[model samples]
Target: MLEGTEAVLAAQLRRLLPHLDERQRRLVMGAAAGVLGRGGIRVVARAAGVVESTVSRGAGELDRGPELSGRVRAVGAGRKRLVEADPGLIPALLALVEPDQRGDPESPLRWTVKSTRNWPPS
Candidate 1:
């Protein structure tokens, strides 16, 4: 039988969480639920997803000892800092869309307005 979302989410959390403190357990589980509730970090962010800085802070707390989550560092592999260093990425990617481009005429890739936003349909 298919598992419910909460059950599936709990199972996923169990895999990611080995040994966790009480607070860490709550926070981490909450984070996982947050992921399921919305979409991802960016979506959560757009929804004022409780501020990534808070999540980062919680992650810091969770990383204080080996009892919660893992002791592995550099989760982003240093790419986060690198991306932050370059500020032109957002504008550059946005410039790829042309206003005149209408909906796709077959399977062709053409941008269109979706949800009042210009985004390529998936």
Candidate 2:
């Protein structure tokens, strides 16, 4: 449908988010949710193309004291990368992916012939 309410709101948020830093984006999205009141977090999040938690953070921020600095996030606030935090992860992943250059026997492609005829299933 042309000019639907949800579509217009989503477009606005998509257009706006790129211009804002992380914290500002959260606050803006949160405010949008706050305006809607109750379940606004879900609506604003979907419209803003962000997770519900992000919107929730913004809403929580609104209820608290003013921001103290220009920091976008708290120290070590987010999750760590799998590769960085666990060295064993690489070995484990490589073992699964045929680390020694030999193919894994359990792979789905193990029995499939590597040919163009097999590629498109002619």
Candidate 3:
């Protein structure tokens, strides 16, 4: 690509990236690189101020089709909630949050005294 074209792509990336979501940015950059053909990944990466690997990943995503549409990452990519792992955590946290609200006596957390450390009741 021409040196002037490199600057144009950089300007375009600057203007467009802020308006796009993470996935969209990657897709756009990937598309640009794909259209540019050989050596486009490095050029796009430099223009976008991101690692070449990010552009490469985007190109891979484009090749992978629309399976990842509308989502920045695959489903279940993040950490699970504490409440998910511990069913009794919510009641325990709620009891802690509202000291005056009596909790079920049978609950193991009923005997837990007030402590500085507490979680959100919601």
What are the TM-scores, per candidate, against the unseen true structure? 0.24, 0.58, 0.61
lDDT of 1 by residue, 1-122 (tens): 23365455545655655676545554674465354454433332333324655444555554564454454343455346544888887666556554555775675576744344644545
Q: Give the runs in model 1 whose Cα sits over 4 Å from its true position.
A: 1-3, 15-18, 38-122
Prediction-by-prediction clash tally: 0, 0, 0
TM-score for candidate 2, please give it.
Answer: 0.58
**Over 4 Å off, model 2:** 1-3, 78-122
What lDDT, from 0 to 1, does candidate 2 have? 0.77
The digit string of per-residue lDDT tens for model 2 on 1-122 reads 22464567798898998999888898888888888787778877877777899999998998895788768889878889988898799788656545334456676453333455655536
Report lDDT per candidate. 0.50, 0.77, 0.84
The TM-score of predicted model 1 comes to 0.24
Question: The CA-based lDDT of model 3 is what?
Answer: 0.84
Worst 10 residues of 3 by lDDT: 113-122
Best by lDDT: 3
Output the number of the TM-score-best candidate.
3
Q: State model 1's lDDT.
A: 0.50
Model 1 residue 36 distance off true place after TM-score fit, in angstroms: 1.9
Q: Every model's Cα RMSD, please?
A: 16.7, 9.2, 6.8
